[model samples]
Target: MIYYETLSINDAGTTNNYITIRGAIDIGHNGKVIIDGQNTRSNCIVIEQGCGSLVRDWIYVKNLYLRRAAAEAFYIHCNVNNVVIDSLDIRENGLEGIKIIGNDDYYLTENGICAENIEIKNCTIISKSNNLYHEDNCVYVQMAAGLNIHHNYIHQRNKQIGVPPGQHEHVDPLQTHVIRDVKIWNNVFIIDSSVLGHGMILGIQSRPGRRDTVIIYNNYIYAGGHLNPGGNPYINGFVLRWYGYVNSVYPPTYVINNTVVTSNGGENTILQEYAGKFYNNIICQLGTNGQNPANYGGTPLETFASSWNMDKTYVDSVRSNLMWRQWTNDMSFGGNRWVGSGGSPTGIINGGWNVWTNSNWGGTGINADPLFVNNVRERYGYVIASNSPARNAGEDLQAFIESKGLPWADIEGKPRNNTPDIGAFEYENQIPVEFTSFSATYYSDKVTLEWMTATEINNHGFKIQRKLGDSEWKEIGFVEGRGTITEQTEYSYIDDIISIQTSVLAYRLMQIDLDGSFEYSDVVEVEILPAKFDLSQNYPNPFNPSTTIRFSLPKETRLKINIYNMLGELIETIAEGTYEAGYHKVTFDALSLPSGVYIYRFESDSFVQVKKMILLR
Candidate 1:
């Protein structure tokens, strides 16, 4: 459970504890593990609990860099269970830069010592806090359970100027209290309006009968206010806050597809108190010097309870009827695409029932002008051009997660195609191959198709197609198009015999575009296994009602593929039962049999193969 090949931990003024891992220690450091806490360290790596009483279970800390930490630089205490902090860089931490503790009086029926399945991924935290009392967060979790903070890049600088506001308290870069199945997705928080407060805070406290199931998706916050070139006093806060415990029973918190941008001394970018479900977000408010006069459009605070009574009709009949008529705040905004400078498209400021805008509530909310490929002035990019109306407009939160779903991609992991192009980047429209990468690989019997393109327009190349199972797609090769480029381009193709044809093969790339327009790319499947057990030969085969039958499988059984005629009877079963080992194809319509000379049989236990075709019609 150790792999340290030595990657420097200078320990300049180390008071001690530059590494105190216990509880099933599995420390790793492939390269750069630098832990220069030259600023007088408090903790530069501690996993806690061991020595006479061990408890940690499978802790795997990855790629680290832990910088000037006079305080916390990665600490996980209280028993721990399956912790995985990945790709970390964690900077100037005179305070918090990752702290996860549990059991501050545990609940969920208290058995004590919490922390379960925690995963902090792709980290880049940069916290420059000189401290003023304490609590300078960049990441701090309290009692946990399956907490997953995703793709992080959190930054919290710019807090100079006599720093003694409240003894300098600049919390939240990500702070969670009584956690439970929490998932903060695709992060990129850069809040620094002198940090008056909130860029991300969940369940501030309260754990009533304990019910927490948050799923914030595709985030990209930027709450940096105060662009004074000699203007005046400034202070703007709140970019995301979800304080809990109001009688407790909270479960419907799912602010989806976010893009939030604020700078005009910020006000509210999202502040919820309960029943939540805002959709396809884009919330912008950049005024001051942050660029384009934006402010007054700030209003996102949901706090329901108008009174349908009966606990708001059973929380409005199990969420979705979305209550709040008794006193107010039963939120449920739709599609969403607001622009800034307070022109008011009703981007959300408690106007209530939203569709686009709130003309007293009748939404479909459209303020137009979402054409950003870059929003200038200090440099920001939300990408959404090519006629940008937020592209496909979006509206499919994976059918409102009843179970585990949503967040397949977007926030730069791309992959969200299926009409999802609202906020957080997912606009790869007008494709003349901007590809970046597409693949398919299987050797020996040959099957290789590679693709790469960082940019290309009006291009006119690529046309490799192949399909076998449900058949009917045949073009096999063609590659040649650099038509218009901007560097980076690579392509390859090879499909020789595919292990004597079929085990599973599906590829696509049409592309073309010099003016002849064409599209279709996003299909790549390959599974080949053949060195025995075979049956191939049935293409156009002198006839054609429909044909295509290739086979191969060296494992996984239960087979039957029949098609006799020419007097052998049993005219069609083409395929049946379990099959999966490799190379298989099936498609035999003959329209309904007749003009024939067909006899195809491929059974399996050990193996048996037969073939003959003519189907001329």
Candidate 2:
């Protein structure tokens, strides 16, 4: 809860109850700090004690600058829990922008605690300058578990900056960590493997345990602007350094839904583990034109293969699929795509992105160009656009074979929209720019309204509209749109005036495109419960489309409800307005909605709920 607001205040100082920070400090003891460096020097704050044991307790450092430190600019060694550091401009440090390092031993000493539940996000961690002392990575995490790393732009350019070439010469590249059961998603890593460095520039590693697992999905990792050495330009595609054997009887590792692009680097293997299940992945080598004697190829499958125990049962499980008649121990393949060619019966049968055993491996399913939206921009932003074929193309093979429904898929095993494409891309109906996802939030004054779009191709913006009972809808606010943007966009509008009249209000977003095209998200209901909102199940089960919707009014509210068809269509309006108090309901039979499956939403002063019903023919 204390702030150290001096550029020179060191962690090796006389402060134990205060958090020593540099630049504008806006952090709270209630558990959040917003450090404003005014976008000046990189060294916003340095935290490394002369002694290893003298680390702080319960601190969250964020939104600052730091440099000339032995480790990351925002460094921590204490065994703190429920801590998060985010939204900063960090660069050019002795180490990474943020470094959270601790071991089981460090935790046990601090009240028998362990480093658990930590998150780092929305920060720019870059290695723009290559100092021999600045050991790799924009961020580094060690021995920490229960972590969520997302929404950060990390780039490692060692050659651009002058760094000598040696074994331990260049920085480790990008964010490097060793942890278990971690989720790394929605981040971008543009690694320039010029100075013969490691390719795992940004990743979370699991120290092999019987139950160890790392779920890496929706990430873009590509190598460019680097020198590709013959042996190992990018080096090991992904390094899962197993220190000891996993003796527990748990399942193998899980690698899914990632798009990895490489150049002259070494071989690219999704599952480089002693044991693991590799599925629903896309690994490509955006090969360079230059041919070196060491030039393996534009995409020389895997130049250097990491050693894995062939005797392990992992290989046996892969071959058991029946499709691989003679699948071998080393499942290494050369340059190829996942989808097979359009051959006859025995060609590309199995529904998975197919890699090849050699450059000549053929199949009718392989796409010369999987058709990515922006290859260059995507090279840095690791997430595929919503329109990308890789979005939901992933086959729920594991889920199906296990006789289980894929909860994470779009719905009902429908591949994104219709038939799925190969690789990670899933080309759903182009998510229009004017299109938005229904959203409702409770605020101090009034319930807030909002929506999100994956991409806005020609979005002119949005208009906030409200309706009461069966009354006609009217525009309340005009939101400026992006006109034309390629990235996912978010917009919000609030109704403070409605709060004084009633506890609930009905609202919707009227998305308007620049060209005058438009679309609407299903109406979402916002209920203002207590601090925590309880979403209630819809009422009048099996009733026609005109069922009465009801919910408890925890507080004063603005509410809204929009009905949609099985085809994701908006058909009816149950209600939208500021309710006085208590429980209430609105009716709307499918006098207008078609006879099929439809979803109706209820948004209160603070909460939102969605329910589905069948309009039995």
Candidate 3:
């Protein structure tokens, strides 16, 4: 590991400027790797490998603050592979924050090598200027495969100084060319055209040999350039510009589960060419407020039409229009909510196009308000309220992906329930009881269930239910609630009649309110053992002074049991000698010890096991 602290390099006069690295290396910083150009020209850092080097892979660059680069901040060139740039703060760069260029010779060769497996994650890039000599961007990648750009906050903050309004055009924050197998997800982009002098542009340039598998999902983008005086509005959010190559097959682009808000300017919020599928997206235009005018942007009713046999004339007209980017009938849009304010009820103007009222294949199209928790000017909170129509309005994307045998999850890391919410956020209404922890343990052929709640309101009690294998759930017993309370409470129940026929059992707590309303807690599963050595969790864990420890033995054997503190110091010998062939229990008294976690060990001639127990006084 090479660490740097406030290191400044000045290479304005040298042609091979900046710090160049080769081979597999890990470069990090304790404070910051400050590379100040002092307004002079130079690249910050460069990583390159020779054409046929055998020892080049896995270069990690992290925890650095790069600023004021005359050219690009970090330049990754030539045949370097497996590059990871993470946790970087790159700001006020001249040309680009990071530029990745593949060797031209490699692309021309029959089986030449290209840069592969590049990942840029958890970074903040703020570019205020577009280089006068070069087309500037925050991050530019050309000729790469398996690129993942996720969880980064990128914004272009206003035009460069001395450039007049409209003269300073903004570049894309993230632009790529000829890259394949790409996934851009879970990023927040807040772009102001006044400050950045350009709208949010997510441009992808596809070429031959590209896998055509690109996914842009779960992003929150606010693109508006109305703040720039005498400047055209930069309202576009995402655009896919194909290189127009006639391949026998084209890879499909998937645009799904994104929340995009465009307030002013620009032609369209989302525009795609060639083959694409748009699903479960929330596209909002601030000007129209959920109403679209009749025939807006010459949008005929057939534009919203969907069927196996599309209108040939309408498709031909769309293909002929250059403004539509040669869009043919090869695109499919569904499960999307287009909300704007204007026009009639069935249609709305969205980025120079008409939003159809008809649902997509997933039956998802709404023009009503999402009823966000706090959605105000410049402070857009996309969280849906309890009463918002977006709740339970989402198509089951998990099911859809499962049908295709693909793995997927929601933006918030929550597994998609049977019915998902419409927008990026899944609304989770608060339950009457707030459970902190729940667990189940088996001992002596009985299952002991325990749970703790941090708070409760108007609670009647809980119905204990159990299920065996694929059988029906049966109500086992009930535990009385404390009615209404804010303090943490603990409860436990035991089911002695666990069916001996089943090897697995599942338990859940159904909390009932005073009004008879109820909600079920997540199920906990337990496995029934078959005459093997096993140790069960201590009952009433975090006990004041004493607790019971249970264990089972398949055959008679001499055993020794001892308790030890967290520091591995023997505290007590609860049971030094055991004379049992079946289930046995021992009482551990910790009246003299302080509150902390302790470990218990049971050892015999052929078997040994250790378990942890908490003691709280």
Q: Which one wins on TM-score?
A: 3
Select the stronger candidate by lDDT from 1 and 3. 1
- Where does model 3 exceed 4 Å of error? 1-35, 50-56, 103-113, 129-134, 159-166, 194-211, 246-248, 265-267, 288-355, 358-364, 373-381, 399-408, 430-617
In the range 211-255, model 1's lDDT, one tens digit per residue, is: 556777887766644442323223222232344434445565666
In the order shown, the candidates' Cα RMSDs to the true structure are 20.8, 19.4, 18.2
Give per-residue CA lDDT, model 2, range 447-540, as digits (tens): 7776776666445577788765567887888888764355567777877753332345578777764435567667766654433344355555
Candidate 1's error at 401, in angstroms?
46
Residue 298's lDDT within candidate 3 is 17
Clashes of 2: 70
State in Å the error of residue 458, model 1: 19
Q: In candidate 3, residue 429 scores what lDDT?
A: 43
TM-score of candidate 1 against the unseen true structure: 0.31
RMSD of 3: 18.2
Specify the poorest-scoring 10-residue window by lDDT in model 2: 319-328
Q: What is the TM-score of each candidate against the true structure?
A: 0.31, 0.51, 0.52
Global lDDT of model 1: 0.61
Model 1: lDDT of residue 533: 76
In order, candidate lDDTs are 0.61, 0.49, 0.60
Query: What are the runs in model 1 whose C-alpha is more than 4 Å off?
Result: 1-33, 38-68, 71-92, 96-125, 128-154, 157-168, 171-189, 192-195, 198-221, 224-381, 385-439, 443-466, 469-504, 509-529, 534-617
User: How high a TM-score does candidate 2 get?
Assistant: 0.51
